[model samples]
Target: MKIGLVCPYSLGTPGGVQNHVRDLAEALLARGHQVSVLAPVDDNEAPPYVVSAGHAVGVPYNGSVARVTFGPRTAARVRSWLADGAFDVVHVHEPMTPSASIIALWAGDGPFVATFHTWQVRSRAMSAAAGLLRPALEKLDARIAVSENARSMMVQHIGGEAVVIPNGLYTKRFAGRIRPDWQGSDGTISFLGRMDEPRKGLGVLLSAVPRLVAERPGLKVLVAGTGQADDVRRSLPSSCRDNVLFLGEIDDAARADMLTGSDVYVAPHLGGESFGIVLLEAMAAGAPVLASDLAAFRQVLDGGRLGELFEPGNATALADQALRLLGSIDERDKLRATGLSAVLRYDWDALIDEILAVYDLVAR
Candidate 1:
């Protein structure tokens, strides 16, 4: 079967939707299905199967800046790609967003499927655009939501129901033996996300650092993602300044190494998380997960049975939980054992068949 995947976000930036599309394409290709991905890309170089829609501009959306593309040129490119590919099914992610996915829905006609991945308490943009978007949305043959939160958002904002399909991951890539250089000591903690984004909650974790370091002088925080490092360092108190190490931007291999080598992996996101993909990555890497008690995260952590959860936006609670987890070797080991077993269920090898079934249903 030939499949065309459309991603609304830029491929050059590291984002959950972009990662999902890339991994899904690779998974399908490995299964001997022909796959092509259409997305906005910043760089000239992309994967052999990726068709660049053009560069993207950052738009403030869902508590963070989303890089997306829109215009006549992008629409023309979308139409041309659809014409050339003539795929059996076209899957557009975040189709309501003002990007390539929506344009693809307008320009192409076939067995169309869309996957919604965002979950917000309320979206004024979605509410305002619902009337205008309904016709294009009606073209979809099937719809999928990455989590129940996402499905609820779609139902509330757009008045539609969708099948719930959680995101997929390549578990083996992160399950490898830890690299020596990336190994962490007793007081080491790791964080991954855009440091400048408040929703990622770097500040919440940073606020807890002084308390953590006071208790354990050897505490070291490893941060990986794109941001202004000097600005972030300046925000920290001088006493615990040297305790944090910023690994500006890292690739997949480095990300796995960083998570695998950490004593604890912290996800401090304040809100706007549909599914905690990074938490699963940490679990797959055998890291003891310590995250905020967001609904999506709570579900991913199995109501805190697999990993530990602290109150959201509470630095004191975060520090206290971190200290307790750091002190208990038995607790961490139990989490690791349970997480490794649970993460396999989300691996692409298992979830791909479910996605293919969706395609089969829509295409038939």
Candidate 2:
């Protein structure tokens, strides 16, 4: 079957939806289905079977910057791409968002499947505009949500029933990757995500550094991903400064290595997380996880059975939990083992069948 996976976000940037689309395309191709990814491309090269509609510009949305193309030219280009692509099924991620996905859904022939990936506390005027948006949304023959949280948001605001299909993982890449050089003795605690993003709670994580190092002088904090280092440093107290190392924007290999080497992986996101993809990545990487008590994190951690949880935005709680988990090697190892076993259910090879079934059902 020929499948066209449409991602509304910029393919050039690193984002959860963009990454999921790319990985899903590859998995579909490996399963012998012809797949093409359609999205706005910037500096990043278009991988095999990827079709770029145009470039994208970042616009603030849902407490984050969304790189999406939403203009007459983009719409025209997307319509042309859809007309020529001749795909049997078009699986669009975030179809309601203003981008190629919306344009394609409006212009392209049906058997359309839309996947919802976000949920926030506030509705952002979308609920009020539902009457105007209903026609466009009705084009979707099937709808999917990455988690129960995402499905609930769609039902409350947009009035739709969507099947929940959690994000898939490149399990072998994280599980079997070699540990990076940074993963040596003295113990490493790692955090991955944009430091300047308040929702990620990097500031809260940094606030715990002083207490963490005071408990274990040899422990090191590895802060990965991109953001303003100065802003992060200002959040850290003077005493904990020396122990924190900023690793700006690491590739997949480095991330896998860091997670494998780290004594603990911290996800301190405050809210608006529909699914815990990074937590699954850490689990797949064999890292003992420590996460905030968000509903999304709890769902991914199996109600705190797979890993430890701290109070959201509470630095003291984070430090205390980290110290307790770090002090016991046996406990960490047990958690890691449990995580590795549990994450297998999310492997792409297993999850793809469910997604393919969605496509087949929609097509029928």
Candidate 3:
């Protein structure tokens, strides 16, 4: 079977949707199914079937960018790709985006599926556009969401329930590809995601770092991912500033190094995460994680038994958890072991089989 993936984000974005597509594409290829990606090209050398989706434009509702629409040009390319029967199913990732969704809506006659990946948090105005796009989503042979929370939100707004197809991780993709600049040492707490705004709890991580460092003095924090990294870098207090290393937007390899080297992965995320794909990635890399106790995060963290859970946006609790992990070796190992084992529940093979089952059900 040949599969076509249409994602609004690029390969280099390092977000859940893009990473999901990357893993799913390769997983499909490994199964002898031809997979193609339609997205922005960040790196010149990409998977064989990828077509450039142009640079992204920032969406008003979400911090992330939606791919630029080339009007009929994009439509033509999409139609040509779909019309060729080169794909048995067209899997559209993040179908609400204006540009990418339009391309998917206008594409071809094959069985098409849309995976909704966002909360649509920007504003009320974007709903008009979202409303305009509902038919296309309705037209999908099947629809999916990364988490139950995501599926509920999509149903409430779009008037339909999409099957919950959790994202999968390609655990060994970064084997032996540690970052050159990464120097793994004792007592390092890591934050790996977009470093913008207070929502992601970068501020909480920054606030917690100083308190943790003051207690242990050996505690260092590694902040990974790209957006607004400068804000995080600048806001770091003088004492703990040097101790906090900023790894601005990394590839799979760098994320692997950070996860493998760090004592604990911290994501105090307050909003916009449905499944928290990064949490699973960290777990797969054998890093103990400290995350918010949101329902979606709980699903990813295995109901908090697999890792430390704290209130979202709480700096003090976050600090306490960080300090605890920094000092303990046995608990850290336990969290790591538990996390890796838990991720086996969401492996690509199992996930794809479930997804295919949905396709069969929906397409019928």
Q: TM-score each candidate.
A: 0.98, 0.96, 0.89
Which stretches in model 3 have alpha-carbon errors above 4 Å?
A: 67-70, 120-127, 174-186, 227-231, 360-364
Clashes of each: 0, 0, 1
lDDT of 1 by residue, 70-108 (tens): 999999999999999999999999987999999998888
Model 1: lDDT of residue 245: 90
Of 1 and 2, the candidate ranking higher by TM-score: 1
Candidate 3 local Cα displacement, residue 325, angstroms: 2.6
User: In TM-score terms, which candidate is top?
Assistant: 1
Tell me the whole-model lDDT of each prediction, alpha carbons only.
Answer: 0.92, 0.87, 0.74
Where does candidate 3 clash, by residue pair? 61-122
**Candidate 2 residue lDDT tens string, 29-111:** 99998888889988657796888878999888788889998888888887877777788898999876788988887787777
Q: What TM-score quantifies how close candidate 2 is to the native fold?
A: 0.96
Write the residue-wise lDDT of candidate 3 on 70-148 in tens digits: 4666677677666664677788877766666557765556578888877644456656766877766667888888888
By lDDT, highest first, what's the ranking?
1, 2, 3
lDDT of 3: 0.74
> Which residue pairs in candidate 2 collide?
none
